[model samples]
Target: MTTSPPLIISVSGIRGIVGASFTDDTVRRFAHAFATELPMNARILLARDTRPSGENFAAVAIKALAEAGCHVFDLGVCATPAAKLMVLELQAHAALILTASHNPADWNGMKLVRADGIFLDAAAGRRVESAYHRSKRRTGDGRVESVARDDVESRLLRRILDVVDVDAIRAAHLRVAVDPCNGTGALFLPRLFEALAVSAHFIHDTPDGQFAHEPEPIAENLVDLSRAVTEAGCQVGFATDPDADRVALVGETGQPLGEDLTLALAVQVVTERRKGPVVTTLSTSQVVTDAATANGCPVILTPVGEVHVVDAMVAEGAVIGGEGNGGVILTDVDPGRDAAVGIALILESLARNGRPLTELAAALPQYSIEKRKVSCSEQDLQRALDGLVQRYPEALRHPVQDGVKLYMEGTFQCPWIHLRPSNTEPVVRIIAECEQRQDAVELCAVAEGLLRGE
Candidate 1:
């Protein structure tokens, strides 16, 4: 007997470990299911990251999609955001991106983007999921063509340049270091740097999927990037995940800035130029709220997911929006989160203010946010959440969307904890933030104790 590897299917799309639960058969099934949702002879964009499995998966996806009666235009080995942009630029019916974004090297899966160039919302995702399970596959006559789509990359870079003060960045003569973790960012960053005339030092610049370190780009995984910034005497350092859809930062002092700050800084920049609503997730730090508040921009809180943020952004006419996990969404450039956009915004922030990243970060409102995960069965997790809700009856509960977020004393700047299940893994996430680090740590401990029935 063999156990099946877990496959994560949600509004985020289907993802699983390659050669495990995610096989050629899995791709064909989802491809066929997605094809059924579109019209006959629909135009579809296909792209992938630099994952070693991407090539084979793309081949399978192209053939599967083509056979299912959708025209497949393959943009081989491109970033995830670029694929989303191409979906809109070409006015395609939809897109299939063959990359398990931010997942491990052995992981490869597909992200299905709707005609609007955004991930399908929960309703749309459910429709696809229902089709996938029915074992009904659609077959139609279509063609597969390999496309360069250099215009996608050019347009992405061009939009970044257009949104920022290009002359200011050039005059600053900024020196920066980057670690793409040997993924698709390696292919885009050089062009961006050349266009900006900024000096750059790159590590793991290869487009191969061999990650030099753990690929999440969080502080713990960015030791090399931190050291590179300090040793190279660069003004800042950046690290992007495998697909380059997200990015994290290191300041001038060789210290890794938390992922939340990436959105905070981006918010600061965008809200300064345009005043509108800012959308983000509940798990995001209050620092982002503070940044937007300082700029007199209203903030909208959504459930914890990129699609949630993007949906709220579009509905609210948001000037900027993203999740706290280093994903920044600027509608002017693209509806999806783009690291290239985040990079340019932060650089422009530094250049416009004529200050170092460390100083700029230090000037932000202070808060301590801690994120932790614990292995939990669904039954136990639900019981723990119920227990916590009862245990803290006085805590003001925000509307339960994806999870439960309880604000201590129903205050914004006070301590708070959010308990939610992981979308991609088999665990429950405990995110707590407070003015003091120890308070946040204690909050997480409390959540963990309840989760364990302690």
Candidate 2:
């Protein structure tokens, strides 16, 4: 018998493989539950990435929301960040984006946004989850309206252009390569490059949801993008996940600058101009910390989630914030991970510094981060984490509120390991970083051994 992946219900939202755990019935029920929590006839925004199942799932959600007495304004085929920006621009009461982010084409999920244009925080998310399980559907005269993709795209582009050094970038006359992985970024990156007067080469530009490779913008998956950069003589290469919320980069020499450096480079740009605290998740690379420190900016570490980082960004008045996994958040534009904004900030850094991407990356403090996952029951996960605590008693530990993060030395930039249960998958994720690749690999191996009760 073929078993399906379990549905991932987390603070981020619900994600699962389509036609199995996540079906039309599942979509309708969740949509109804989401709507029942809103005001009667409340204004809501709806958007979806280019997953093959997204169109149908979105229709199911639209019907459920309208039947539950909410007006839906649909932004068909749009980036996740675009959907977020439109929520504020249109003053919609709430928004629901149908996307599974970097997950494969067979997967789809719902990301619920509050009125403030941010993903639901833990408390708000809990409310939605509770409603999903307990609330019943209601009916009223509600309607669906179409919001043009151009408007959504323009609003996002203008936000990014407003903050970046457009003049400097234009003067640089930079050539770039983009691989949107046949997803939402294909819809808007061309327009953005045109506006910035950047010469761009695009691959996997089709928005047909049939991904050219794995949807994740990791180094191994971006070989084509790297080749495009070198062959086309581009200064940098950008690869965005399906919903365009995350981006990984390829440097001028066709070298994949792992996702962690994406935030480090952006931090270098932002902290150079704006001197405020920088916020990042605990699992983010220490290079980001080094970048912030070099610019005399304070660094704040949050639990491993975008909402956690965004919350800290708001409280600390952070000039910039993001995750290690190629997610960048600039509160000036949106309090969410935005690939468009990340791309713009990176380009501006190259332009203002008059440096190549490879050189700029090399100048930052370097660290090697290795990630691995092991499937385990929750009880076993807790047991292994307990064992780690006993084994690393002398190590400086973090808050333990989110996960177990401990630094070998009593400092922020030292070799470190973090073990946390995955909210998006049925496994425990182990991340470790060290000054050398071999050390990082060894650290993860240790974590894996502990996880296996060895």
Candidate 3:
């Protein structure tokens, strides 16, 4: 029998195609590593999304943690952020979320959180990976047993409600449309909307492990959401990925508001209420930077990933943070990405501004960004990056991070370009930001030319 490589292990967690990179043995190894890294007798929180294989992976993870002598609290079929919140609410030493986020239904993975509810950074992830690789198997007595599920769910929901002004949201009386993509968000979002007294139109809200569309909430995949929002005359439409860690919005006019706007709007909401530092990944749109600056706040840029952004947030004591892909991180609630929190924050912004969702979104600065990926082997990646750097030496600003990011000055059209290799795929992703779409597209073409040795 052929065995797959353990679901792409790294600083954050393991994620890969089900029955391929992720299997029971792989889950056990990684969980054991996590257990070893955490303190002995540590109480760990475990939760899974509504994937067909989630329960199997969760079972393996629980048993591994238990065998490592850790107490486990299992919350079945919960959003990724909910697991993080439970870690902080329950005062557990760590939390493990079994989800693949926006990946296909056939994929499953895990995200790790510390006791403080922050995702593990690159260095910490490496440590866990090393431990996973080195750990020796110990016999029985180290397995997870069931705990109280209802109590945990109730407490988690209450914690979420306490952070937002439920009455204020109700007063707005905004009609909202939500598509959970048939993931774990379906488990809690309806109850949350009811508590806020908002009228919600739901699609793909069942936890059936059957995705109504592509699991990603990107613009191309949100056509139904856009139509539903306009047809229902909803104030706004929100869609979450499989794990519910990220969210995408559709404007009232059935127009898909880019994912970057989600973060931009959330930043506007949070910074308006409480002025503080904001953090976002480098690939994020400048709208977030503009929003933060307008509110007398500075935007901190990190490498592309939730953990990197959260780490910067913690260091800067940021009030709110998020990524370009619609993942909002509210530090006051939990440093991890939370789609539910994002919905409440956006509604709060609307209520406070006394404006419609479209109007609020229209007020932000506009810019164009184009993203493209090219498949390349490891050798070709190194060669292409070297060539690009050599061709545009004057434009280089930083190169020590995940990939090379260039800042265009002088008469150059685009403002910036970020080129990074994918962690999960054999592709190099190039993102260009400019004042015009044509310029951004042209820059991507230039990047492709360089990669192809043209």
lDDT accuracy of residue 313 in candidate 1: 90
Could you tell me how far off, in angstroms, the CA of residue 328 lies in candidate 2 after the best superposition?
0.6
- Decoy 2 TM-score against native: 0.98
- Selected candidate, larger lDDT, 1 vs 2: 2
Error of 1 at 154 (Å): 0.8
Give the clashing pairs for model 2: none
Q: How would you encode candidate 3's per-residue C-alpha lDDT over 296-359 as one tens digit per residue?
A: 9987888888888888898999988988989998867766888988888887877677787778
Residue 99, candidate 3: C-alpha displacement in angstroms: 1.0
Error of 2 at 317 (Å): 1.2
List model 2 lDDT by residue over 85-161, tens digit each.
88889998899999999988888998988888888888877777777777567898899999988777788888899
- Full candidate order by TM-score, most accurate first: 2, 1, 3
Taking all chains together, each candidate's TM-score versus the true structure is: 0.98, 0.98, 0.93
Writing each residue's lDDT as its tens digit, candidate 1 over 1-454 gives 9654499897777889889889998888888899999998999999989999888888888998899899988899999898898888889999999888888787888899999989988898888888888856787899987767577788788777878889988888999999999999999988998888889999999999998988888999999999999999999999999889899999999999989999999999989989999999899999999999999999889888788889889899999999899999997888888998899989899999999998999999888999998987888898988988998898988884766899987676557899999876657899999999999999899899999989
Pairing residues by index, what is the TM-score of model 1? 0.98
